[model samples]
Target: MNDHDGPTPGNLVATVRAVLPSLTPAAQAIARLILEDPAMVARSTITEFSAVSGTSEATIVRTARALGFAGYSQLRFALAAAVAREEPERLVPGDLGPDDPLTDVIAKVTRAESEALADTAAQLNPDRLGTVVEAMVAARRVDVYGVGASGVVAVDMAQKLMRIGRPGHAFADAHLALTSAALMGQGDVAVGVSCTGETPDVIAPMQLAHKGGATTVAITNNPRSSLAELADHVLVSAGRETAFRPGALASRISQLLIVDCIFVGIAQRTFETSQAAVRATRSALDEYMADTRRRNK
Candidate 1:
């Protein structure tokens, strides 16, 4: 139900990263191989992969299953599919290099962002999305919390909800966010957005909301982080950081894609009200534009 209309082989590296912490050391090595060069791993047989990882075939099978694949063969199939699905030009490593031409920089950035969007779409679970949308629609009010780059996305999410006649607020300040969570209760819902999943500003408010009996949701890149553990529903975005912009998420296209899905789902669930709200909002904007034009004339 995502951009692909359903699940396709997303980034095999992302799938592996989601479960990386739980893997055994030997299995972890093989997992790293999959992450590092999935194309090579895909072409490698069990015996060959075993030799590459310095692990036995038995360990390979266990690693494959741990990664949610049926077996080693299935793992390789997914990796191959993911690699094959990429554009031929994108086959090269996406890392930005120093002293590279400006054109190459542009291409690398576009490639990274494109991969982040597609991989995020692939990893997004439709059932979880439905749950979040349902919670948003039924909530008395929704509070969104984020800081820095994620805060921008939080504002966009809240704006979309408000345009659809839903009571939504975005808080960038920790004090304001915590205050909002303080009043939340059973019928309310709170969402925290943090790329690294460890942002104290976001996590504190969401944890408080959870303790106050409100439904809490987390949208983060790291599924194994504290924010994910705290929220009632966790939405993961597969945005791998690139050397171009190490810490900042830039436009955070992957997270925005997740928000778009949530907003669309909620709008679909309450079509008539949302449609009317959108129309009304648009008319107000049009009127403002007309007034500005008349004044200019």
Candidate 2:
């Protein structure tokens, strides 16, 4: 496939330039609209673009088809990717400025979540994530190890997997984690979550697990991080850098989303087993709560 074959909404400007001359007058008009305002193309649907460009939906589809995508979805994805690359500093909408009034916390949180969703879209690699999930699903056991703020996310993932009857542990202590890592073998899975991906404490154990022949998964903000390089499968977290604002917020949120994605994938793939596990776990918790209530009474 040539460069044009993988056109994303982000590269619509380039695609328009490359294909404009070849298109008929009607298609060229749509191309002009896209180049003039690629963000509009990124934010709007094909039908909306067609209406705003004064062209028919068929014309838009034909234009995208001519540009080498299977359909309009591919074209829009390309456009959004291109736009995201251009703006490295765009906070999620309402997060544009800091120091808002106390009453605006809700709006701020909403914007932050919106940005998280967009970052997830811009950075996620479905193929890579699927591979990691597959490894977790087939593993004999799973170990989740992390340190610092990422450690919290690791523990949260462990709890969720436990509910689904996956035998896993989240290790916060360096020594205990290393010992557990030494026990990992082929068919086991070891996960390391680190935003910077350079934490020595987290990497040391994951490296041992990798050497033990276990399938390793690393969820990190940096795709090029040492953690990603060490693990067999990498789940990337999309987050923005900020000053005075802790990486804790963005990194943890992204990590949570990554865990959620993996959990959902595993649940869908092992529907019956996961459902039974969930039910059993919930029942156990209810029974424990009932016993506590009776004692109090």
TM-score of each: 0.83, 0.68
Residue lDDT tens for model 2, 84-129: 7773234123443467675686666555655655565555567777
Using TM-score as the measure, the top candidate is: 1
Least lDDT summed over 10 consecutive residues: which range in candidate 1? 1-10
Residue 165, candidate 2: alpha-carbon lDDT: 88
Angstrom error at residue 76, model 1: 4.0
In lDDT terms, how accurate is model 2? 0.75
lDDT of 2 at 136: 88
**lDDT (Cα atoms) of all candidates against the true structure:** 0.81, 0.75
Judged by lDDT, which candidate is best? 1
Put down candidate 1 lDDT per residue, 1-297, tens digits, no spaces.
112122236555565655565567888788777767878888999999888889999999988776666788888787788778762233334577788899998877877777778678778888889989999999999999999889999999999999999999999999999999999999999999988788999999998999999999988886767888888888878666655685445337888999999999999999999999999999999999999999999
